[model samples]
Target: MEKSVFEYSHYRSYLRMRLESAGRRGSKAQIATEMGVQATYVSQVLQENAHLSLEQAEAANVFLNHTSQESHFFLLLVQKDRAGTKSLRDYFQTQLDEILKTRMVLTERLGKSTQLDEKDRSWYYSSWIPSAIHIATTIPTLRTVGDLAKAMQLSSEKVMETLERLENIGLVRKEGLQFLPGEQQIRIGKDSHYILKHHTNWRLQAMQSLEHENLKELHYSAVVSLSAKDVDKIKDLLLESLKANVEIIKDSKEEELYCLTMDFFSLLKAQK
Candidate 1:
């Protein structure tokens, strides 16, 4: 099945935002004129051109100074646009969420200092199972259900059930009688690693977990922007932020750091 309408729109939206940011001044006219095409071509690419010609894609790379990561992401968008028969975006998005959830668990378990009573610890452990499967498989050679169960001390039955659920939700597959992840699955796995390593549950939950209001004194901050330039800046800023925050936790009362984590979101900025 081709990507869902939502995923298609999102990819297009991302492309459009990147293009617009790259061509900051008169972006529409600049791209159209450079490509020897009409402004509508730029519009069409975002709305209908999922698969881009090499020429068009190259034009984007040249115009955007895209990093290797951005270039690869562009290729993915192009492939999806061409395939038009499978909604690959949905599959990966689901997997990506699961990976982040696992990272969140680890952040709470390993990254923070908290005052979790026995009951809280049990609840935390139970909540982290699904995420554990997601993270465990990321450790190559331990990707299969049995492997994940053994590595994580989870029941095989439970791991298999999670894998089945992931499959039903379009995150995994049985390719040629062997399990395989679709393109999106691979991307999700790759993405989760970075988020888990750098972004902790304290940051992620702080973005959405209003109930943790008491922690506001930590004086944390957020950065948002549409420009890839800003994204780069935010990445650096976050690294500094997390580093400093971690240092503070190490020196503070251990209980205050308990069960804390962080979250990071990198999305195309909406056009002004």
Candidate 2:
């Protein structure tokens, strides 16, 4: 199925999907006419991932009948594609991040109840399962115990017990055999007392994942001695990358459950 325009970061792919939608066969010519360009030009441009002028991109936006937000996103995609230098591309990328953040703010924002009490924190973060199950309920397919059990590779009884425990903490709400996110939101910060346990739970999960032969999963380990100066530089780069990635996660629609773990530390003992 074709995704909404907002879901696409690549303009060419979005155009191709629209043109090829059912009953819209040969729609490239229509778009060309809308943009005051030749049909062949549109055809070649899409196939080659060629740049579209800002003016042409605006015309295409109108032809596609995009919403205001989607039009803005579409223009950003074009601007990024047309950028000739890394700095220019990075500039447009920042704008794209803002657009995504604003769109997500209203729907994804957590409530004031995000901070859990001490006991609740202990129970919730004791193992990854409780928190994981709470988040999984947000996924449409994981609403049922059987569905979640199969997806998370757990037995139905285990899923049920975890679900019940989560419900007690107001993390999951059940309605007619379907599970949904609870009214209260849960957000843990680095300063949280249980943060270490939460991190440990997921880190252990990461280790187990290595046992599986998933070709698409990523794992990297390195041991090296570098200048103290470069240590800060490398750490800064990783933090910057993770910050950009968080923007994507905030705005992306949930379709699957995945975990990302990044660890970098000094092997040498610290001097007092």
Candidate 3:
């Protein structure tokens, strides 16, 4: 499962694109020249047809201006890609951001060819949330919980207990009989800061890993205080907003006021 230079090149290319977007500048040609390689070889790396050596990587740092950790991450990606096992892109997508950030630390011991030790397995399981709260808010309204459980074919009590735990952490709120988030909820665990620090690299992986992305439709029976006359216009505005994002795939309407949600890893990369 050792990574080939070709795979390493792909990682370098990916980083190059990301840095470009972040307003950083670099030249692959210049880096190749510095490493005493032909620009064509550099082109192959960018095309993912070649790999990078530690020495070449050092040269890239001079050109791409990546930090030491970043250079290492790029190398890891390439190595993982070369092993021809799990696709790093797929892994990145599937892994929570928190986990992705920290996994690098144990690369030597947990890279593609490595097996999880008993302790590592335990740590991995401990970091995983039983279920993800997919609602717009962290707190689940009773009705929302009922519907979600039915959809997932789980008992309502199971869902409720999970929400209750989230509530205990000050991550959820109850207003009257309805559970909702006190504010916006972005999934973060104790190890999530690393995700923010390496946001772009992880974001691309997230975008790739969301293949089964789905949204659950939810409706509330409560009547709103808003004038009925404004409902049509509000609905129009909502529809417009939804259309603004090409990423929004599924949306459903129900008889009562409703919201959309789905369970997913918020920060699997940093779960622990």
Largest lDDT belongs to which candidate?
A: 2
For model 2, how does the per-residue alpha-carbon lDDT over 1-272 read when each residue is reduced to its tens digit? 45666677778888888887688877898889999999989988789646789999999977775545567899998988888899999999899888777756633543435555667777888888887888898889888877999999998777877886665556776653466788876787888778788789998999998899487889888789889999899999999999999999999887888887789887667742
lDDT of each residue in 1-272, candidate 1, tens digit only: 21221233245666665454532667767766766678877887767653457677667654543333334455555554555345676654554455446645744553343233334333323444544444444344555666667766777667766665443333444321123442223122333333453334435545554644564444355665467787688778988999997798656642221335544665546733
Candidate 3 at 7: error in angstroms? 17
Give the candidate order by descending lDDT.
2, 1, 3
Residue runs of model 2 more than 4 Å from their true location after superposition: 1-114
Candidate 3 residue-wise lDDT, 1-272, digit = tens: 22222233356556455433433344555677887899778877767678777687667644543334445555555555555555665664343334454644544333333233433333223422322342434333323555656654667666666555544333454432244553323343446443343344434434544664446533223435555567677777766766763244344322232323222222335745
Stretches of candidate 3 off by over 4 Å are 1-12, 15-26, 84-99, 102-272
lDDT of 1 at 28: 68
Clash number for each model: 24, 0, 13
- In order, candidate lDDTs are 0.51, 0.79, 0.47
Most TM-score-accurate candidate = 2
Residue 152, candidate 2: Cα error in Å is 1.4
Q: Rate residue 207 of model 3 by lDDT.
A: 54
Counting only residues 3 or more apart in sequence or on different chains, how many pairs clash (N, Cα, C under 3 Å) in candidate 2? 0
